[model samples]
Target: MMKAADLAAIRAIITRAKRWDLFFSLLGILSLMVGVLTFTVLFVDMAIQGVPRLSVDFFTSFPSRRAEHAGILSAWVGTVLVMLLTALAAVPLGVAAGVYLEEYAPKNWITDIIEINISNLAGIPSIVYGLLALGLFVYYFGFGQSILSAGLTLALLILPVIIVATRESIRAIPQSIHEGSYACGATTWQTVSDHILPYSSAGILTGVIIGMARAIGETAPIITIGALTFIAFLPTAPFAGDPPAGLFDWIFAPFTVMPIQMFNWTSRPEAAFTVNAAAAGFVLVFMTLAMNGLAIYVRYRLRKNIKW
Candidate 1:
């Protein structure tokens, strides 16, 4: 129905549109390259300055008043302990809430309200979470300035992310899978546990790892919870000694994490401490990268194994 001139005009328009799309795509790739390059340069610089300082002693000894003798033993140990607590607190609750919302909750105004609140919570500033922890956990609940307080604060911060990730993963499972399970005389719990959870594990794990990576690097919330910045001693052992400090003693102990330790070192006037900060930064970056890599590997393996 179109004449030759109109056909040519349409072709020209499409050509221009494709040209613009290609131009924008190239621009976006360039931007990504720039970011990667910048991070590479910074990482290289830090490695040069800090790698020489790293030794077995750096991991074995505790923080010292003298920069030459300072180490991150307490800092790293507290970091691990806090992260363990965060995982224990956040994962089960987040997963359960997500499962309930996606599978059991009725489609109603209450569900909509809950969903909206979660979406808003995800966008809230980390510092605000810190303040809330300070008020509720530290003061109101009598958690004190302890690892438990810090861990719980981070748990709350990452809960929304985990819930959303879980819900999305569950949603991705084909409805036919559910129907087939029901057709086989499977209960709702059995259907979810057998079909939905196995298929969604990869996505959920990826989200959890990402959330934890973010939590490890967080300084504001822990600081607000009154985490000590100059700890030189590890928390009381959970299960060692003639009479153990009790399994929960460490939770109530004062602690310092790698991020806060790095921050404290960076704030000092000495060049040596600055170098220490760089080394700690390198460790933290390495940890975060390892977590992300694990998440990627898990997703790849799961996707590969399950064709659907």
Candidate 2:
């Protein structure tokens, strides 16, 4: 029933819209390729400059003033221990706070303010956390420049991220799931434990991985709290000390992480130290990738078991 002129106008509009769509589509592809290509080039350059320096001894030997002989033994070990402690300190608190906020806390202006503050915290610069940790963990609490202090600092840094991730993940569960659990005469805690927690665990782990990846690479906070740049020794091994050191004694040991080691090497005058820095950077990236890969695999497995 349309007039020929009206039909022609409609066709013209469709053509114009399609042209704009094509333009945006091409723009998006260009942006994605730019990022991918940039990363590929940088990674390849690092490998070309660093791969030859990697060897079995490079992993085993302690750092030395002689750059060619230096290794990351202490750096990597401290990174792992600090990360382990970070996880221990952050996970439970983040998860519990998230659950309380989402599942139990009353909806009110007070809760809104708290939620807004938490979200804002996620965007606060990492250096501010470092300053706070320096004062509270190092000077105030007398934790000193130790593994425990570093661990707790990084834990604080990532807590907001974990809490937000947890809330979002729990929010994603179907409303029907909660209603069904309630219909079965389940209590709030029971419903949450058996239904909510299991379903959202993958998402929670994803956040944890992201937070940890950020924590592992952070140098500002660690350095602010007096992490040594030239740690040639490892934390004292428990039960191996002359008097058999207490299990928690290592928590108070001085520490260093990979980024700090790389920073130290890169700042040196020698070319060999530059190569060492590149190699350490390569290994740090690999470790981060491996951690993410493992987390992705675990998330996939978790999702596979999910009924919906």
Best by lDDT: 2
Give each model's whole-structure lDDT. 0.91, 0.92
lDDT by residue (tens digit), candidate 2, 1-308: 99999999999999999999999999999999999999999889889888999998888889999988999999999999999999999999999989989899998998999899998988898888889999999999999999999999999999998999899889989999999999999999999999999989888998899889889999898999888999889998889879999888999999888999999999998999999999999999888887778778877886787666
Candidate 1, residues 101-193: lDDT per residue as tens digits?
Answer: 988899999999999999999999999999999999999999999999999999999999899989988988889999999999999899989
Each prediction's TM-score versus the true structure: 0.91, 0.90
Candidate 1 least-lDDT 10 residues: 299-308
Give the clash count for model 2: 0
In the predicted model 1, the residue pairs found to clash are none
lDDT of 1: 0.91
